[model samples]
Target: MLGRIAPNLLIRIAGRTTEAGIPPFVDLLRIAELSGNLPATDPSSTPAALLTRFPHLAEVTFEDVVVPGPHGPVRARTYRPPHPNGIGLVWVHGGAFIGGDLDRADAHWPSLEFAHRGIRVVSLDYRHAVRGVHYPVPSDDVLAGWRWAASHARELGVAPGALHLGGSSIGGNLAAGVAKRLRDSRPGTDTIPAGLVLVTPFLHPFGAPWPTGMLERMRAATTNAVVSPEDLTHMAWNYAGRRSVLDDPYAFPANGDLTGLPPTLVITEEIDTIRTSGEDFAERLRAADVPAVVRMTPGAAHSSMSRPAEPTAQVTLDAVAEHLLGRWSPRAA
Candidate 1:
């Protein structure tokens, strides 16, 4: 019966009848509907198509570079500003470890936005689980990209040791894992990044217990359409490939040590299931004497960053820019 009904019509009906208010942007519902109508195909091809469909920014310049990944050569796209600021950001795209590419709307737009603000953005096209790859492999690819950017910083016109790392969704998981690796590699050296920018990062795949009121607010924020526990479990299994490795700190950052990470900025949305994990990670960093902050976007859902023009997305972008540019204070958010 549900399959027989139109997606838009179903969305409208749910909006009208549901106790939870409608999601902030009607465009989000439209996107969901459109996605449901698309043919089942290779997830790898989706990002290029999405980039073509959402070609909004034109001021930023982009160049493709191939980095030597652990498995093979990984393609990365660098977004550059007209004027340089001497700071670089290495970004990872999110796709539940099965999908996603550098050209994804969420990844592209944020990189463009940051580039426009004078930060050099390098977005990595890491190996995905769908391609028969699994944990550590994906993270390894991301770490390779980071190292490439760091080593090539002078050529990229970015100052050495001024590189920051970030990602959204699963990309966030990779970024956090990479940061941990860098932290542990050299005990006394300043191998850590300048900072970390995590946007609605999926740091924890396993659901954590949240307060009743917080859960209700998240449900209302997402209109009860967030990722279900079953989907999370499947995604975890697919990415890890083995149940025993799920607890590996690098694979699931929630299980990792939080000490010695650089100053971190964790941005989350009110309605997303990942919000709790991101917030909890920030708390863990603070407890470990790391400078960490959490910025919560009100009434936003997961992947809201994909809709760059939305108010919530705009606010999140501004917060990220301010934090990276050293204008944001921990007490301010």
Candidate 2:
């Protein structure tokens, strides 16, 4: 639609150009080639490359750090803005709950961005991947980080009562799970997040590899099918401990009871398979009397924010800032 609008017509025209009938499987092939494919698996190395690429990103400042989780230490980096902090964002890093580190660039970028907007951001580098320490384990570590942050909110310059939880991709999934748990725990009247900001969140695990009823969408599309069906099945089992896929809350938040979650902002790219997760969760949150909003970015794919200065990339960050600033308003309960 932007292609038909006013000036800047040429750029939109160029961006809009695509094979008229190219299969969506083409997207899967490109993503599959890169999704689980890692030339260097170290989390720090992954973000270091991005830091080298985007030199202008501000450096992260840590006022305090902690790794007090039970199973193992998860490093946390806190980013504090200049003045009295008005809001706090407990950010969980994304790595399919198996791989991530606060020392890495990807983990720091979002927090750095939040700090620049005057919100105190704590990024978590929780235990990941290995058996006995995944899924809800990561969720536990993130909530631990949040508890630590809340305890230190005053010293960290955060406001009297404003802490919002945020995450991206799988981290967002963990945050949603943790938020539900926190809601039920209800430690006290004053100990809970104000809202949730989810970016390209993977809210559902039951999404089939292909669209429903597509018997051979990729039969001839050799370039597609990232993470073979075998890997998908294995990941589900590994994530939820060998349970039937039908009733695993860890696997799908959309299928869970969301009666009391905070207001939520969920941004999804149309090209990602997990887009369904974001949309369904947002709608469900609203249906259950929780405030929620779903924002979609066109002409983009998942993982675009980690890439360079694409329009969608900046838009994604802007959405994060808006949520932190209390500019986002999901429907009130």
> How badly does each model clash, as a count of residue pairs?
0, 4
Off by over 4 Å in 2: 1-56, 83-85, 186-190, 208-232, 244-251
Candidate 1's residue-wise lDDT over 1-333, tens digit each? 333345455556445533343222232233334442212222322445534644544667899989998789988998888777988899887766665566666677788878888898999988767545678898999989988988878888888677899998888899998998888886754356888989888777585556667656566555445654545666677778888778888898878689878889999987877788898999998999888899888888886776654568788888888887778666454
Collision count of model 2: 4
CA error at residue 312 for candidate 2, angstroms: 2.1
Quick one: RMSD of model 2?
Answer: 9.7
True lDDT of residue 144, candidate 2: 83
What's every prediction's RMSD, in angstroms?
6.7, 9.7
Q: How far is candidate 1 from the true structure (C-alpha RMSD, Å)?
A: 6.7
How does model 2 score by TM-score? 0.76
